[model samples]
Target: MSVEVTDQDAALAYYVDVLGCELRTDVEVFPGGRWVEVVPPGSTVGIALVTRESGIPVALRLGTSDADEAHARLTSAGTAPHQAVIREAYAPPMFAFDDPDGNALVYLEDAPG
Candidate 1:
């Protein structure tokens, strides 16, 4: 999964430092543009910081076998933790957090079918 952020460093810090994702690469497709992707440790799916500026909130619903555990990790890193995890109709076990620039983000797990 990919999402755009105002700055790559901020995004990387949050995704890496706070979210415990591993920096996948230093690959730069555009020399002057934001170009980096990070994946949650032991997970193949990744969140990318692109150069698309949009007002629409980017909701990247990421599911983990361990949401409670993930929350602990995020909070332990001193992120202003807000408990947004909820499983409801049309959505399941989703939560949100903001980046340094207040770009809305969400990672959620769906109810079992």
Candidate 2:
């Protein structure tokens, strides 16, 4: 997933420091532009932080082993989740939160497989 940010360095810090994601890639693609990617530990999916003049922020659903724990951690870190975890029968337990750049993201409890 790609997220647009006004500042790549700050975005990288948030993803790495706040979210606990590891830096996967950071290289200048062209003058005044960079291609930065970060991924959750042990996850293959990577989130790219891009800078552009126009683009809508992304809403991403991420899988977590425990929604409640993840929510607590993020809350304590000052990410302010949007609401309490939803435990509806029709959906997995989940909660939404926004990144520093206002990119919406959801964390859903992963079902046993």
Candidate 3:
């Protein structure tokens, strides 16, 4: 999962100091970009704090066993997906869609361990 925040520092502080999530990863991946992830206690998933300019979509990402099936189900239920399931070498199969309230979300096919 990930969230788009205007300020990474403030977001990090809130998630860690206030929310009690542990800082998982804090590294500068590029000259001007930093990757910060926080995980709740006893949880395997981490929430990545990113900026809009970071090229990471600000969406709630859910894991699905089959992206195609998930997409079909959502489409059939009248939820219009933003696009078709994308299969790329750099990432898992996934698709983006908006909820009834228009909040962005994504469903990613689970990657094998």
**Root-mean-square deviation of every model:** 11.3, 11.1, 3.3
Candidate whose lDDT is highest: 3
lDDT of 2 by residue, 1-113 (tens): 67889888999999999999999989764466576889987898889898774332355869999999999999999999989998966457988899999878889799878
lDDT of each: 0.64, 0.83, 0.89
**Which tens-of-lDDT digit does each residue in 1-113 have in candidate 1?**
56767777788889899989999865544345444778898898766666565332354546766566666667787654456465554334656766567666566664466
Best-to-worst ranking by lDDT: 3, 2, 1
Ten-residue segment with the worst summed lDDT in candidate 2? 52-61
Best by TM-score: 3
Q: For each candidate, give its TM-score against the true structure.
A: 0.43, 0.50, 0.71
TM-score ranking from best candidate downward: 3, 2, 1
Q: Give lDDT tens digits, candidate 3, residues 6-102.
A: 9999999999999999998987766556778899988989898999887667889899999999999999999999999998665689999999998
Better of 2 and 3 by lDDT: 3
Q: In model 3, which range of ten residues has the least summed lDDT? A: 26-35
- Backbone clash pairs for candidate 3 read none
Model 3, position 19: C-alpha lDDT score? 93
